[model samples]
Target: MDVYIRSVNVGRPRPGIEPRGRDTAIDKRPVASVEVRDPGPKRGGLGSGVVEDDVVARRHHGGSRQAVYAVAREELDWWAAEVGRDLHDGVFGENLTTVGLDVDAAVVGERWRVGTALLEVSGPRIPCATFAAWMGERGWVRRFTERGRTGAYLSVVQPGRISRGDPVEVVSRPAGGLTVPEVFRGLTGDLDLARRVLDAGILDDRDHATLERKVARRTPTDH
Candidate 1:
């Protein structure tokens, strides 16, 4: 199954929305490229720029990927109603807020073709304090994590221009027993689920390494 973007909406900080402790919300604006940083303090988190392939290193980091998203068109009306407004002029922080596809089901390593662009599912985003601050809900981050509705991230496998209303189709589904939601749960310190993802063999080398490390941390000696 594949998902397609019906529209692309961007959002910036609104009036009276102060940047609370550890919160960084900027005014909504159009960007040529959206950066996805790893947010790790070490490993010079900015490993390499996906758009530029430049190795400008930094100690304090967050992963940044050029924002490309897919949403179903039919759901826009519902989303607008829930948000209490129309989706134009950028209100949602999503660079690409989409409507038709099941956004939550896309798994890592899965590839989708949008127009001439090819995107590979990379990882699930970790909700941050900024998101909570934006929503004015103190526990929003925890709640979102608990709900496990965090959106999937995609890395440009074959770079090409993408625009609103582009049709998206799944070109390939990588061999893996676990689904996208399973991977997201695993990243949130769910060891048993992580084990399932590993045993299922859906994880690539990097993911496999990370999961093995987690398993080792949980089990000091081989079982």
Candidate 2:
């Protein structure tokens, strides 16, 4: 089966569930098409590489490395079945709802060409408190982390227009690189997996340092 975009989604700020009451863009809706480009970097940089997609929580979301987010339609269907609800595209705040892709298996630094844009897989989507509140399910964060299908985040390498049904072509993959699920486990406190990912050396400097600190803090004997 060919990998393709099932929907192109964007969102506007909505009333948030967080304690601080900051607005959130978790309620995304599908659009016919979207223009994608690098948003530079987080904090003082342009937000949401998908033009017009709101990234109100700029402190933790949106940046050059996280220019776009894609989640597999199959995963959504699975979650919908699990929760006994109809989970629609973009409901999880993904910019792209994809079909025929095992997003969790994608290696970090893998490149995909969708429509005219080139995107490099940068990391996995880490579930946040906003996501948990949005789901409104008990122990949603722990449940999601355990499932480990957190879809991939991409950095735009070449700007272009993307639309529903656009084919997602894997342009390249890093040899022996860590997959999205592996990275997600590491990020979610799997010290052993994190140490292995660090050995792979696919993460950028910032992420590398972050994981290093996390692992070091948990493994005192490593020092």
Candidate 3:
């Protein structure tokens, strides 16, 4: 399917803990490269795409990379609709806003072409306090985590410049029956769903191990 960027969003760094309290005006910036790293510091390599030795994924809340998510396209729209605003209003903190892509359905290892850049769906972002703060609600993070619509994380498969209004197309679908949504649910306290994905056996080794461990921890007998 043809994908396009609906908007390019970036939050002017705020001074305090207030999520929407931005002291500076929002500005557009080109997406250098999207990344998905294991929220855990124990597993520190880039999850699915190109990574340079110097580029270390920022860690939050004690090595939880999942907390800070970059939402894409339709999912961004959904987030905006939930807050009664557009993504450009600085609600999502997304550096690159995209459209015309079913980001939730994209599985890990899948590649998407946007202009000269190619991005792969690496994993589902884990929602955090920043997300709740952005939405201006106390329980927004929990709600998102429970709902499993945290959006997909992407890694740069091909280095190229990306801008707003660029068209994106899915060039690959990796071998998997579970979608990004399924994986999100699996990670966020849903062992049954994780088990289903494991049984399907379509996930890559990394995903499979992660899902299995999560499931085993949550529902030992099933694994």
Candidate 4:
């Protein structure tokens, strides 16, 4: 499979999708192109790193560490089969829908050049309540978690424009970095895996502390 960006997506706020009637930008649609940049930090940042893309839930989404979200077309096809429906590009709220990339397997700190912009793999996207509601599938969060091919969140390195059909080149990868799925599984419930990811020192300070707490809180039965 040739690695490339299949689509670029942007979204606007829509009311009433999430519980509490909070606005959501999860229903992203394909666009011709997008300008990627760092959105600073979460909760007090400029919001979506992709220019003009809405990040309504600023407190929980979009930041320098999560400037862009990428989902593999192959994964979407697999999900379509599992859900018994056609899962289109951006259905999972991705900014870039990619082809031929095993996004879940991309190691944290791995950098890719797509079009003119440089993006670094930050981590795996964790399924949330809004995502669960959008999917409308029973036990969607748990099911998504169990499946664990949660795609990737990327941080912008060099601000530039990206478009559909742009080649995605792996420019660099850090040694000893954990793959997205490994970190996701660690943060989800596997104490051992969580510790391994933390020991790898790939996560930012905030994430590191968060994972450390999870490891400390491991139940007696968790291995």
Name the candidate that leads on TM-score: 4
Per-residue lDDT of model 4, residues 107-212, tens digit only: 9999999999999999999999999999898999999999999999999999999999999999998887788999899889888888898888877788899888
Candidate 2, TM-score vs. the true structure?
0.95
47-144 per-residue lDDT for model 3 (tens digits): 21222111222432112222222466666567667767665522455445666666677776677776567766656766655555546665877767
User: CA shift at 75, candidate 3, in angstroms?
Assistant: 3.5
> Per-model C-alpha lDDT, please?
0.53, 0.91, 0.55, 0.91
lDDT tens string, model 2, 1-223? 9789999999988885654687888889999999999998788888899998989888788999889999999999999999999999998899999999998899999999999999999989988899999899999988999999999999999999999999999989988888999888888888999999888886767788999999988986734
Report the lDDT tens digits of candidate 1 across residue range 85-117. 664422334444555666667766787776567
What TM-score do all the candidates reach, one by one?
A: 0.65, 0.95, 0.66, 0.95
For each candidate in turn, give its C-alpha RMSD to the true structure in angstroms: 6.0, 1.6, 6.2, 2.3
Best-first order by TM-score: 4, 2, 3, 1
Off by over 4 Å in 2: none
Candidate 3 global lDDT: 0.55
**Better model by TM-score: candidate 3 vs candidate 4:** 4
Q: Which candidate ranks first by lDDT, i.e. highest?
A: 4
| Model 2: per-residue Cα lDDT at residue 208 | 89
